[model samples]
Target: MAAAKEGRKAPSRKSAAEEQLPGIEDARTAFAPALSGALERPRSMLRALRFRPPQLLHLEGGEAADRVALALWWAALLNCDDPEVMEPRASAMGPCLSCSSCLRLGVNMHPDLILLDGREGSIKIDDVRGLRSILGEKPHFSRWRVIIAAEAQALGIEAANSLLKVLEDPCPDTCFVFTAPQRERLLPTLVSRGWVVTLPWPEAGRPLAEELRPWEQALGRFVSEGRGWLDMTAARNGMDAAKAHQILLIGQKALADCLAGREGGMLAAVFRRMPAQALMQVDELFVECQDQLQAQVSPLLVLDSMAARLHILARR
Candidate 1:
């Protein structure tokens, strides 16, 4: 029963595509090549593949940057017989992928690694403090500790400042890798501290899938689903306002209808097509949407949050 309820809330592909058109497809194409390359490359040496690391790696266009990040992490771990001492356990895992490989690596048991998650709400000060405490402790398994903040943008002012202190003067062997859909979500101080790697959009005029007019078919499906399940709240869940507003109202209705017609558990299957980490973020956005609706915040802000969430959910 719980699984069923959870399944219903999941988003569908058709609905996801309907939420937006050319814009969403544009993001899809942006990282298509990179994604294809990574997925096809069998689990091997990702570092040897000319993989570039941008301090502020921007996964702007599609889910390409996200894929690249995941691949890099996996490859590094696989190759590093002793990543436990290098990358902390906290930095190793993420919101989506449940690949417990790290557990076998003794990473889950490592005290040096700190997993900072803010996908539920703003990453609390307590969470930050805990990480600091872990960092303060001498290295248990590895010389360098790692911190992977999945939703770095969720850091409140205090939390961000606290993290900034460590990022600026990180321990001699400490490395921090933060991920967010948009750079604007982070403070300038944080952004400036690291190298910036922006994910590129797919080459213009890329070939379209054979199903329908690539843009039109996808747009129609996404918008229809989004509108049907459209909740007018949750506008502030995203980085931008106006853009998010447009997405929520457009996508809500479409999403609901797709679910209604499914025989059973279809939505989950569609979502499985998306990246795992991305799926977690999308779920967070949906939760925020509901919160905004109940809080009766700016209807526009709520809607925008929904839109941005859907946009991320839809991107490959």
Candidate 2:
């Protein structure tokens, strides 16, 4: 028997009888606004998935729980039985909250849904092997079998290689969803095989570590005073690729917060002074710096180049 139909009661007509899965509601609420704003691109991509679903879907960024909630919504929509829910009407923008499949997912009682929580521990080769038998079978009640691997960065090398092979040749009507803080954290081979979606950071904003405060302050000064404020010699001495990466990450977050009209101290205040277009350019610069660092560029060189570019933008 397929996992979907076994060890679960038949679908009930009264959706109210089911209780929501723990933490799902809060996760949903946290990401709700972003779905329409920061997450709109991913949401649009979901429409395409409805026609030809990808074998592997990788959602990078955002809180792990929030990503899971979005994945659940996708699963619910793919399997929803309500006829009226098929249209793209405003009223039908998301999963039909009252349908049997939606209800089943709400409470996490759906037989077709498999959740591999990496937070528990490392995902081993054994865990990947266990899913083979389940994937071979057809979905019992829904149109698609959804396997959500939350915090997929925890997957060990063997497990990632095992899962990568599965992604190369996926079973019919099955989708594997992986969530992590960033795609760079996952195996390059695995990342290459999936349809990757970049979600926004949560609206609440991620707090920067206290140790990063000096770097943050330096960023503010550089933005406000242009290249004159930067000390290339000191930066070269004090910065490594890892530290540079963290600084860029912090800058990206502050820029995002500024765009969202959130008050985020000095960094945000500096970002706010720039026009939206300039801020976007800064965001792109940060991404470029990250890519350059990944490609083994000298951290000091990248920082100097970034400072030069920001100086021009600050003048504009």
| Number of the predicted model whose lDDT against the real structure is largest | 2
Instruction: Count clashes in each candidate, considering only residues at least 3 apart in sequence or on different chains.
Output: 43, 1
Full-model lDDT for every candidate: 0.43, 0.70
- Cα lDDT tens digits, model 1, 168-253, are 55354455656554566577888887644444433433323243232233333443355422333322344333233223322332
Which ten contiguous residues of candidate 2 have the minimum total lDDT?
1-10
| Model 1 residue 251 distance off true place after TM-score fit, in angstroms | 7.0
Per-residue alpha-carbon lDDT of model 2 for 1-316, expressed as tens digits? 0123212232333334334333545434533543556566777777656646677888887766667767777777677767544544533366665665776665567778887777555567898999998888877777778888877866767788889888767487688889887898788998887888878756566677798777777777776776443564264575655556666767787887898788886778877888879988898998788777655476678877877787678778
- Which portions of model 2 miss their true places by more than 4 Å? 1-37, 87-92, 201-316
Instruction: Score every model by TM-score.
Output: 0.44, 0.56
Cα error, candidate 1, residue 188 (Å): 1.3
Best by TM-score: 2
Model 2: lDDT of residue 202: 60
Query: Where does candidate 1 stray beyond 4 Å?
Result: 1-79, 82-110, 200-301, 304-316
